[model samples]
Target: MPGVKATALSAAILVSAARAEPLKVGGIDLDTPPSHCAPLRDAEVPKAATLGFVSGAMTASAVYWIHREQRRRRQPGKATHPREWAIWTRLDRKKKGYVTRKDLKSLCYRFESDEHAEHLAKQLDPWGMDHINFSSFINNFKVVQMMRQAGRLKLWHRCCGLGVAGNVAGHMAQAGEAGQESHSATKPAAIFSYYMPPHPYQVSDQQADKKRLQEFPVTYAVIDYPKLPGACKVQVEPELGLLVDIVYTKDRKRVDHLVPRRVAAFNDCSIRSLEGAEKLSMKKNWGFGSKGISLRSFPVDGFGPGTFVDFLALVSYMKRDGEVFQYSVKAPVRNYLLFHEPLLEWIVEQINGQKDTDKWEEIFPQLAASDFPTSSWIALGAGEYTDYGATHFLQPLDEVVVVVYDERVMPDGPGMAQVLEMFEDTPAPAGSVMLHQTFV
Candidate 1:
């Protein structure tokens, strides 16, 4: 068997190949690529509902009859959708298209109601045709996963990637996974935490006793100084954020699928010390911008392939006393503590089985009640801290900057070998996704 590094390369190539063309699995050949064409004109579709109803019924009848006649005229086996256009081209006897909304519901691996199916059909049929155009459809839908409603980031259960908190102990434990061997006795792991925004009112017994939890106020972004509570020490945890799509059974009691779609630079910032802290979340949330994430993101197309994310690197800096200090070691996302498909499966298992303890909070009940959250944003984990970052805490008038950039896009020359090489004297470069925040 190939070593982990070789296996990773093989997996990446497989993922890239799957993305490049129609996929066939389990001995089933898929549909041929669709022809390129502009969306159908508005004039081709009836405007009024009455006209549409009548036309739709007539069109259905005509299509059904024509399809039946065609099937009768063709040879027995040839009546099926052409082998080249196999799965993508499931010629519906009634719908008059290769694929329909019902087919999409099954193929996409998510179950939906009638209304949801119609909504998907409307989005896919840009020209008002009920059928989807496979090529254009793949270009738009396959790359990104969106939530039905913009879910409150507060609703999200913020999970912290741990096992990187200290220098010698944490580093030694996780080093082999970072090096070529990729196997380890002490596996790096993640812990669950949650944020509670400051609110004036007290939690009443009526609210706490209810089956559904009350919604908390959400602060998704901040550009200025954040209000630090009391005199607690605070530090930023620079990491990458992964947005995942989760599907659940109709009963909403259990999760069926969990897939990552987009990756963005993230700051899993936290307080240095908290009194009687049971879970890490107590250190995580304080107020608006308590956590930081870049406004920009890239899709994880075949995540292992690195086609979309490998070029990126994470670096953070602190501006204090009129001078800038590198606050965290520059690390690539691929060098993260845990990643790829094994990590993905591990996370799903963690959510389902993790129990409430003196040091960790239970996640299974929260997830089940939230219907497995159609979406989740997860921080990959933090990297090695700089000397200054390890010693100093946030003080008033200090500035913190975190950036994620495509190192592959770094310009050539003696001064520009890497992003850090260009960071000595100048401000952050143009293409990097940067977040600059000040302490108040």
Candidate 2:
């Protein structure tokens, strides 16, 4: 009693008077609100937000480091884009994950063909793909490859089909290796033309006068390249860019190109528009293949100075002074792409190297010529030249090869050298050229 008496009794009396909530005895209430909510204060909310940001930044840093490492692996001095950076956020199921290769394959699988079914089939074989299955895998680039090689694809169009599926190799594969033969895959290519018919410069003078056709003169210039059979060779430069073909007759005496042929800059004549002369004079057109639609060049030579022939060495020439002309190779359909990258092997060798080869067997028996056909090339337009130029072809030119390389013909030293040499002529493999011919 003595211990509790003094201040305790006074405090108890005061506490009893103050013990109350915002209460109304009848209707009136008495209470004052705190400046902030007790449970969720404004200051506390901001502190929570700050914590969230810090956590998010840490997460983002981890993802960025991974991507940065990946980009570094691809090629030196390469950088990533904002969109690619978004891929990290996508791993969170609630967030957007950009499409991976599987997503693309699914898109390919689901896509019902409106126009590409048959074309895709004939073409699929060269790449060892199945028609519908390949359709799912083939993106814009495969489309371009199909068109360019249609001439060949037509022969075995129904045979190509690839069966690549998602494998764990993607994750387990580590980066870094020295002196590895590297390659890159390009897609949704444009169609390129390989063969253009000789121009009709052979028409008699009366025929020319009657039809009001201009003479497409043939000019001979010496160019050299590693592809030439001997030291160097003189060949007709096809100006698909100029919309003309330079054709050579069995008899070398007469050669002709498409109408847009170049003439020697004559004396006392302004070098302006002599029409035919100005047209044919240029060589090596550079910009023939930019995605799809692009500019035109004159003779594949004026494409870009010193690009292609530089790959070729200097060679001899015999000039045809009489006249110069062009031959047009306009054909059955719209300009399409011709692709020939299939022959290159795609090796993801950590483990799939062997497994992939085995899977090909299941997919290979059904394979046809279309599975392994040449589809496109770096066809140039006027002033277009082939560099790493990713040109497209409308229709691929057909080649009659004598012998296709069989496994027994392994690419060992000299064997491979011969094969590489064949790239120069790109001739029908031995015994393939038609023997029966009539000289025009």
In model 2, the runs with Cα more than 4 Å from the true position are 1-60, 68-114, 117-143, 151-440
Question: What are the TM-scores, per candidate, against the unseen true structure?
Answer: 0.51, 0.17
Candidate 2 minimal-lDDT segment of 10 residues: 262-271
Best by lDDT: 1
Q: Candidate 2: what lDDT? A: 0.23
Q: How does candidate 1 score on lDDT? A: 0.53
- lDDT measured at residue 403 in model 2 versus the true structure, 0 to 100: 16
User: What tens digits encode model 1's per-residue C-alpha lDDT throughout 241-330?
Assistant: 777777666776666666778776677776666665545555565544466665456777656655666677787877677677878777
| Model 2 lDDT at residue 429 | 35
Kindly list the per-residue Cα lDDT of model 2 for residues 91-124, writing each as its tens digit. Answer: 1222232323333333233232224544544443
The clash count for each model shown is 5, 97
In model 1, how large is the Cα lDDT of residue 190?
43
